[model samples]
Target: MLQSIQIMALPLQDLKARIDQELDENPALEVLEDRETISLDSMPEKNSEVESYFENSSDPGFSSSYDQAAADSKQSFMENALSKPESLREHLIWQLRLQPIPEEFFQIGELLIRNLDENGFHLEDPELLVSQDQHPAMKEMISIIQRFDPPGCCSADYIESLKIQASLVVDVPEAIYPLIEKHLQALDRGKYRDIARAEKIPEEEVLHCLEILKSLTPFPGREYSSAEPTYVIPDVAVTRENGEFRIMVNEEEIPVLGLNSFFDQVFQESGNNDQPGHAEAKSFVTSKIRDARWFINSIQQRHDTLKKVALAIVEYQRDFFIHGPKSIVPLTLKNVAEDIGVHEATVSRLTRGKYMQTDFGIFELKYFFTNAVTGTRKGGGSYGKEAVKAIMKEILEAEADRHLSDQKISDLLEKRGIKIARRTVAKYRKELDISSSYNR
Candidate 1:
């Protein structure tokens, strides 16, 4: 049980790493590479005389049970290996290689690529690349690099980036270039009426232009960011079939283990001999086999417990899976523990760093558990904090005409049956990294 608890606390990747380390340290433990079949029937039974020696000693329950199933061959080793992310510098260099630029300009392009920040904006002045005599050549090279795959990559600021991207579109309205160049602050503040009046265009046209602007990527270089991407392997998968939600444990990544047949044979053959040191050698082998068997069983037990806890979470948050995150109800570790017949600590340990892949998206197991926020009406059910946050985000997104203050947001939520205070709304807004009404 202690071993089960320890294994349960480890995430799937960490558990795989632990098993790899154990395989390196323990000679008795070996991976069964062939997946065609696994049968322990060929394993010899313990000799009657050897059984008498272990009968007197306390049994650690390792010899009682063994895994005989084969691992699923669908998950290959190469699939789990990490793939490095391409950086912005590499992407620009690749694009430069494809062009028919002269050899001398290639050095200038490489220098420009190296000076770009993570946002794809140049860090230094382009004029600094060469003397005044070669200023025209430097400007020409900069123009070429800016027109690479990610349209706005080599610009100095967001305004320049948007202008560069605007130039690439075939039928962009004549007013868009001026709107982005002159009235960026007004546009950010959602002052569409001001822009319409300034450009002498209709309000509807301003809205249409804004929609076109929205389609442009603000940070093009982020697509090929240099930072390493985190890879998550789901521990459980929830799928909807025939209007029913089904939960399945993801055991493909985990390897199926069995006792080494070679070690078993050696122990069996040596048990019958009466050499001076045969008994000590046999005892040592028995201890190693017992340890390996216990490790294998503990892994199986962890798998079973993880599945049970995951199923309980699915049952409790059924509405969330069917609808969406906004439909998530108030839940806690205690709720899942009670449903699955385990202690709260055990449930918590099993869920740590565990992720579940559903039709909606991949979410950590803890995302389903949320604190309850009381409802405004007396008989109404409490709301999950996550649900309240989702509603808040929607409200903010739709408030393009006028930003709603915290007090206004609280009153709106109260009308919807949520009993959140103004201060609480402000706190949640801050956590969402949303600015106040004035800033918006």
Candidate 2:
């Protein structure tokens, strides 16, 4: 049961892999092809008892529903068959092939490419490659490759990459290169005045150069990454139609499975035989048939449980879907578990790594579960932690000229009846990646 629930929690691509593994291991399990449909008539009837069993079984009804769903899902599957993206190494190699460099230089270039890390910076010392004889030509090749499409392909570090990229700009400020070379630490700490004092330039001029420096890419190679992108397929989709939220489970990717008719016929035939090996064959066939039935039933249970949990979550967080994350109320796994008449562990398993697509955006199912932060004032309503974070983010964004300290932000929230501590405000700011008031 836990394994089945875990399977339900998997995203589309992962679920497909799991299904492929099961099909390889279980002979009784088989995927129905596009042209094939499982029906009672498809199975061979060797006797009255076998025909009676087929008529009373639930397999025919399940197959009918599976066929209908499969027909409706064909177009969606085709639409989702996306093409693979090109990587950074392939792009660089193509450019190198087009160059008129010497054939021997190509080997050196390939070595240089191998030394470059994912961020487009050289991992090994370039001087290590050159002896006294090939020093000048090797240095020239390295320089040429550095000036490739990314503008900083073979740099040693971010400072070197920035310098190489800055040289490409026609009207780059003179102070920009010196600042990048000498005072990178100060620049990171937002110390513009220190840079101005050292360079004997005005503070405003230092600020201007800082703006230009910010425009350069620190990791140029990451822009054309070779890694294959992982796509997310939402398990549930919530859309609004005429002011009502409807929850639809994304079962289009799941394949319908059934027992092989050949195996079913063998099982029926072996049951009537009285030969020496007939008893053993009959036992084996019965076991396979039972395993196949259990596998199909488990899949159906997983489908039903996913739909039930999704509907309950949609009903519980209706206000959030309508008004956005700000309106989300405090919720927990226990609340959803009790609502859906399932255990807390079951709810947790269902939500793990599962995502839902809403009219607002695609969000993880666990995103809706937030702890309640009590208001300071008596008789006031409690606020969700996510709601408080959203409010804090809004306050920070609107502080245009004046920089608000954590204490000041806490006071502002208190005025709005939130009563969060200054430390809590600072922690939230860090989580949101907002710098301190001094840095701002």
Candidate 3:
């Protein structure tokens, strides 16, 4: 048998946004005045006070003055950082206009600016520009922009950026200039002996060229913007005080909500009204009250769900909470969902945009769930990949000589309990920004 079953659920915050979108398209929806707007400067100073309320399309005869009243007192923090600065080419073109280059070279400089990369490299081929323009003026402009400040600001790449920097020193040896212009790769590779041999110069001379090279900023444009530090507001704060951990929802920042009491009285009294305008006013208040109550309830539900999920995480990763990162146990979303008797997706949704503050650090709820090392008895570890990464970090930290190759670290981990291969170890090491043994 086929049948249709209708189900009803209150809207979450995002669903409320969708409802608003729908209302924009729907003709029947209309905004009603809230209770507070009715009372103003001309009041008799009686005991009557204005109340807040909210409404949706479905309801027609309930008034809520409490829910909206609670939300009127809270504040939100959502400031964003300033955007990154402009590219190096934009900076150079401004500088180029001041120089009295020939008319032909000035156009070429403009062409060169168009081709410069974010790192201030001249990416466009001069030969291509010269052939297409067939004008000495265009070629001349390109060259002028190429010679703008930061030297290699318009060069095709870092090599040019460096060469331009080297050219600024009038007394720089001719041989040293060529070494930087051509053998910059060898210089970066610390192939001092090879560069010196090729240049027929002493290693000491190569060092001097490198000293000059080191003075230039490869990405000079980055210096334009001041680093704007962003502040993170934790959804939940868990701190240890007096030998016990305390869990608190940071409700101070979230909007509080309650129903309007005066509106509720109006709804109760209006159902008995036979008067013409009285019924409509009652219906309006009723709808607003329902919406206000639903919004308040949804907010409460969001908090409740977050609390359950976070508490479960704390309990499962007890060692991590007690100690720190290193003690983090293997855990997964399924582990948490099953423990909470909710679907994994439900657990995921509850945690999606939430953060927890602890003595260890503020972290995303999902950050605690990671793939395990050795499989658990039921097939998965109760710990997170972060825990495994922490284990690898610990092994490398205590390693002899303060450094260990990925292979050696893998071997040491296998001796303990982690069963990862050398390649996996290398992968994790790379993720941790641990350089190769030689580099370290």
Candidate 4:
């Protein structure tokens, strides 16, 4: 049961990998039907003769052109691969190779590049990286790396990175350094008056300098970020049809599995034979059959539980499906457990790593569950924390001359019968990855 629960938590991609491993290890288990819809990019050229293979889709009146052997070969040929992007270190090293530098300096440059973090800022002091004898070379490497393609890497921090880029680039405003060092915090908070008074400069001049610095990125290495977008196959799909919601567990994503007749016949024939030599063969066959049956059954149970949980979610979060993400109400695993006649642990495990596609977007099933917001409004009105966050997001995104404060947002929520504290609003704003009003 524990093992099955773990299997239930696997996403579509992980589940597919699991199935592939099982098929390779156990001859008794086989892909009885797997029909995939080929996209335009994957489709064969005109006048080409190729068999169509689909995974987890119903037959669309097409047949496989390949025999069993050919089918096995095709499955091996078509492997899924996740592409990786160029890393910050790679980008720096590539540029370093093109530079006309000594071997010692080149090695020091590679060492410096490796020490830099994702923001193109050094993880440690450049002087500390090498021995005292090589300190001078390390410093030279740091400067060289700072002047790399990004023009801001190998610095101590974003503050230093901005300064480094400004030095290398032509026509940098003289006021750019002071503004970034002293008045950046004030400028971020819209305190132009304080900045102008402190620097004895006009507000227009301050704004002009800030605009010039905008061309220089504080974190230059981010442009070559290796972080790739996570691709997911939604395990469930929620569709609205004729004023009703349809909750479907994506059973078509996994291939239909069945027992291999060859293995079955061998198992049966070996069992009938009384020869002692046949005992080992019969025992092996029996074990393989049992293993195959359990694997198939476990996969089916996973889908069944996923569908049941999805239906419960759709029924409870009907407002979310009908209206959109903001309409999602407060819900807990305990609530769904009781509704589905299962334990809270079962509900939690089933929902983990599972995604559901809706009209709004694909969201993890866990995304639908959020705690209720504190302090009910007048007449006992309540709000989900996520719903309140969505509303807060909408408010912040609306056209405005100035950024709204956390307190102002809190007041706005209160007006809509969603009573929440200013601190809570700020917390939610941060959770949504939105900068504070000061940095907006």
Error of 3 at 302 (Å): 1.1
Candidate numbers, best TM-score first, in rank order: 4, 2, 3, 1
Residue-wise lDDT of candidate 3 within 1-440, one digit each (tens)?
Answer: 01000001221334345445534543233334333244567766643333223233345553454466444543221122234554465677788778887665656667767676666655666667666655666645655565666565655666666666667776776776778667877876678999889889999988887777678766654554344676666778787778766788666554334555577677677766888787677767878777565545555666676677778888887788888887787777898888878778777666665678998888877778867667334544444568778888888777748668888887777666567788988898889898777557
Error of 4 at 372 (Å): 1.6
Per residue, candidate 1 scores C-alpha lDDT tens digits across 281-398 of: 8888888788789889889888888889878888888888888887888999998899888899998888889999998899999988999998878798898998899888888888
Question: Which lDDT values do the candidates have, in the order given?
Answer: 0.84, 0.81, 0.66, 0.83
Candidate 3 Cα lDDT to native: 0.66
Give the TM-score comparing model 2 with the true structure, all chains together: 0.75
Stretches off by above 4 angstroms in model 4 are 37-87, 123-132, 169-187, 190-213, 374-380
> How much lDDT does candidate 1 score?
0.84
Q: Give each model a TM-score.
A: 0.59, 0.75, 0.63, 0.81
Compared with the true structure, what per-residue lDDT tens digits does model 4 show for residues 1-440?
Answer: 66577687788889989999999999999998885645679866754333433422476555545367977776666642234567889988999999899998898888889998989988888787789999888887888888888888998889998888878767776777888887777877778878888888888888887776777898998998877688888999989989988888887878899999998999767746888678888888899999899888899888888888888998888898888877878899999999878889888888888899999999998999989875455565466778888888888888255689999998888878888888888889889999887667
Lowest-sum lDDT 10-residue window in model 3:
1-10
Model 2 stretches with alpha carbons more than 4 Å out: 31-86, 94-101, 124-137, 167-178, 198-201, 227-230, 239-245, 393-409, 421-440
Q: Which parts of model 3 are misplaced by more than 4 Å?
A: 1-118, 121-151, 155-163, 166-216, 225-227, 260-266, 274-284, 375-383, 395-403
Taking every candidate in turn, the Cα RMSD to the unseen true structure, in Å, is 14.4, 11.9, 12.9, 8.0
Question: Model 4 — TM-score against the truth?
Answer: 0.81
Name the weakest run of 10 consecutive residues (lDDT summed) in model 2.
Answer: 59-68
